[model samples]
Target: MCWQFPLLGIVVDFGHYFVHRAMHSKFWYEHIHYVHHSLNDGGPLTAYYSHPLDFLLGITAPVVLGWWTIHGDLKAFLVYVFLAQVGALYIHSGQSWLGNKWHYQHHAKLKRVYGLFGISDFCLK
Candidate 1:
């Protein structure tokens, strides 16, 4: 019995959108995100290059908020978590992009890619 499906959807989407935006900020980039830059050629493993703090920010922020909002139910929490993980894997994947090399370009150029779902960046270009 899903008590709050619509609200949960809103929360999840908004959380992802805002959290992704936050990842592009200078503060995040300077400290934690820089580790991922070591990957001059991004691929599946590029996700692992992220600093632990950035990982916490990317994964835990929504989780903490979700925990605060939801009752103690493992089922809903697990589902939300699964979806988030799948999304993360896909976004980090080098498979889908206008150019398969765009991510590598960012790394090679030592610039940031602000698009969480793509290899595009206003600042990094």
Candidate 2:
């Protein structure tokens, strides 16, 4: 059961990566995802400061995908959600030490670094 945590994270992160990438599409970005990009120099609170649709796409949808696909014990889902939110906050915190410098690049450049863990960016690029 414990081992499932990593697997669940991978699945959820994969879905999150794609959804985040999709949000960067011109149509999506202009209509929805742009709300998030507005916070170019954002802090932790900016993690949730997104258009409702962007939130759904960038956050909720990924969790839902994990819920359906992994459907593990409740503990796993809870841990995933917790970690996901924490990671979101960390990425949006504008703290370089958090280790995801590419996220900052995403906000700054808007054409690169479209994924959460960088896996999608690597593959899609």
TM-score of each: 0.58, 0.89
Q: Model 2, range 11-51, lDDT digits (tens) per residue? A: 66678778877787789888988888897887999889899
Clashing pairs in 2: none
Q: Where's the lowest-lDDT run of ten residues in candidate 1? A: 115-124
lDDT of 1 by residue, 2-114 (tens): 66444454554555456656766789767777787766554666766688877676657656675567552677667766775675555457766545454555567744444
Against the true structure, candidate 2 reaches a TM-score of 0.89
Candidate 1 deviant stretches above 4 angstroms: 1-6, 16-20, 97-125
Provide the RMSD of all predictions against the true structure, rounded to 1 decimal. Answer: 5.5, 1.6
- Candidate 1 has an lDDT of 0.59
Q: Report the error of model 1 at residue 33, Å.
A: 1.6
Give stretches of model 2 more than 4 Å off: none
